[model samples]
Target: MTTTSKLIHGYEVVIGFETHTQLATQSKIFSRAPTAFGAEPNTQACAVDLALPGTLPVMNREAVACAIKLGLALGSHIAPVSIFARKNYFYPDLPKGYQISQFEIPVVQGGEVEFFLGDEKKTVRLVRAHLEEDAGKSLHEDFIGQSGIDLNRAGTPLLEIVTEPDMRSSEEAVAYAKELHKIVTWIGICDGNMQEGSFRCDANVSVRKPGQPLGTRREIKNLNSFKFMQQAIDYEIRWQIEQIEDGHAIQQATVLFDPDTGETRAMRTKEDAADYRYFPDPDLPPLHISERWVQEERALMAELPRAMAARFVADYSLPEYDATTLTQSKAMAAYFEAVAKACSQPKLASNWIMGEVSRRLNMAEIGMEQVPVSAAQLAALIARIADGTISNNAAKQVFDALWNGESADVDAVIESKGLKQMNDTGALEKIVDEVIAANADNVAQFRAGKDKAFNALVGQIMKASKGKANPQQVNELLRARLAG
Candidate 1:
């Protein structure tokens, strides 16, 4: 190992991510607490979730089924026996004082998730995915003086997915997170809501040489956003490099992401496995998953989003870029397919989606799950343009109204707002004559064989039509009239 590598946390900027994906089950992992989003604080909590005395925990069957489905999808070995353990920790948010997690034998292990960085496809190895119970949330706001602890989120079912140190850069980290996000949501296992903490990442980062002892690593926790995850890793890497260059020894620690400053600060020295005092829980028995359950889950599998993207490229005749963008999320892929099924041109549907539809969705700070424009609305707009009832420019205006709250009816908005193009033969012919008369010098230049002079007349026709004349038809009419 090179001295430099043995020396940022030494070797390379080795990265491993631990992502927590909340299961889509209606109840908590081992309790009956309602798993609804945006519930009133403490209302969803049950006696079991509150960890009261004399309460015995019971595991949810649906949670197990969901985990098995995910395990099969990742091509992992479903262990015949898995045990739950208590990870002792102290925090205001943790109502149970100890988190119920897996220690020695987890549900699934030795799996792989595949992704394409560019032209080259690659796979990131998975260490294990275990079932864990989430802690409650501490609300710093809405209380007069003291922070409130909301147990509503407590006992929530979480699948903690740990990865091997295979990623080398922040870009790879982001891409890996994105690909995993797609997979969890696509498989109907997790909701994949980063904002709601349904999906979160803890980045394990260290620096080392080509061949050297690994440097002391820090765990950066709760990287809830994609941008923040990338930025935190990059900043931590640079900080480690600078520390080594300054002849400082790297210390193992736990850190948190400061999204406001786009940096990572050390929270505490990282804990070793022995520090947690993990042990199997006597209350809960070992979970034995059989071949029958695995087979049942395999039958319930849906086509993966990545495979769907490839099919769109081959069958729908879409650009790889378009297919990739539209198929990143299940809702978007379904919406795009509906538009294409409506017989609107495939390329045209792609253009509108990647253009105005995405633009408006981003502006509104919403994802495809809450997309305002429906497939039928988009398909109808495309059809209107195809039939020459509205020009491309007018369609954009109608789409704007459709995206915003201005208008709900695409066709009515076109007629009521006078946004339709001047496609009438007689009306357009009158405008063409006026444009020729107004630009006499240009008309003379065109008659004398200067082909470019006709552009001036086309611009005039568009201006006379209030910028609503079909530019293609205007150009064709201008060429014929000028040549004659």
Candidate 2:
């Protein structure tokens, strides 16, 4: 928990998270049913998934491997032995009367997620991450007064990561969520596709007076987007505070956020451990993982984002912020590396990628994988800037041409657009001389120690040269002429 809590309405907001990350395995948790999305309902649920009579559960090895990978990534302890329990629950979409999940001895235990909330590092400690099988979807859009059950998602492999109530605000919670999302997607365990329900967050939110005991929390379910996650938490915090201020006792319940209404409504009373009636599953034995298996999985893992960012800082001499921004995704980091290596200019490459490339990507609402400009093209453009073939402004023109598919060759774009800088010293000297002669008053101000006057003269020289004059050369020539 954050000690320096910024109270809202004289109450400290407390938040914890339960994230359901669907593992990227080819099959379900206990069956061989295909785990691909977009299949027709009831077609993918096998006998084992449907809990048919005499069909015993068989654990998927790949799912356990994925769990181990997550444990390693989060610095969690991977238990050599863990138990699967039957959680008794009644839902229309749950074909099995109970969900197979971990109750007491979860596979992963005692880790923490670290993230930057606007330059202040925040850490959210993990209570546990357990393996579980997902329930099916209850579809209600197409039917009137009747709902459809899609068992295709039943028995899907999932890792439910539970966090301590550490976050004190919506922004901190969102940052933590984003960092966790990046880690999971970076390691290839989960796709981190919240839109398709592959990644989901349930936030438990409450508010209490400073130094008071923790308030009763209401769990907001299945937040699919980061935007909605922050919004829901903010609203819930305000609601809880309002209830307390109005002398109403806050109830502990599960709630759902209505994005359309921007308010959360109670779904049902939250269930405790006893309410679920959890018991060890008799059909499946205890899960046993060997130390050798953990080592093998760790060896197969790629360098994580944090380590990659640190390397960028050390190897490329980049600022911490630049390194962090560049490594937002694997594709982005790979793109930066390719451009930097080709041009042998890491700082210049970092500037362009974090500045122009990021701007275009945001405007197009696309990821780095969908960027139109290739690494070679960007490298060529950066090389031109570094070699004084063009100015920064001219390089932007070349970048625009490449991004919009107007031209593929950077040199061709520069030649056609007449973006090459005026490198002739004699010609630049002549332009600078003429500008000084034309602007006598500005010259006198510069001699009088006014710096803006010198800038005005430089601007006039560039204008007289049609913006092709090399700025460095212009500055040097102007200083020499004024001195003489």
In terms of TM-score, which candidate is strongest?
A: 2
Off by over 4 Å in 1: 1-13, 31-57, 73-75, 85-99, 112-123, 135-155, 193-196, 208-215, 260-262, 274-284, 301-303, 367-372, 404-412, 416-461, 464-469, 473-484
lDDT of 1 by residue, 119-192 (tens): 44557889999998999988886557768889998899999999988887787788889989989988989888
TM-score (all chains, Cα) for each model: 0.77, 0.95
Task: Note the residue pairs that clash in candidate 2.
Answer: none
For each candidate in the order shown, give its overall lDDT on alpha carbons: 0.85, 0.93
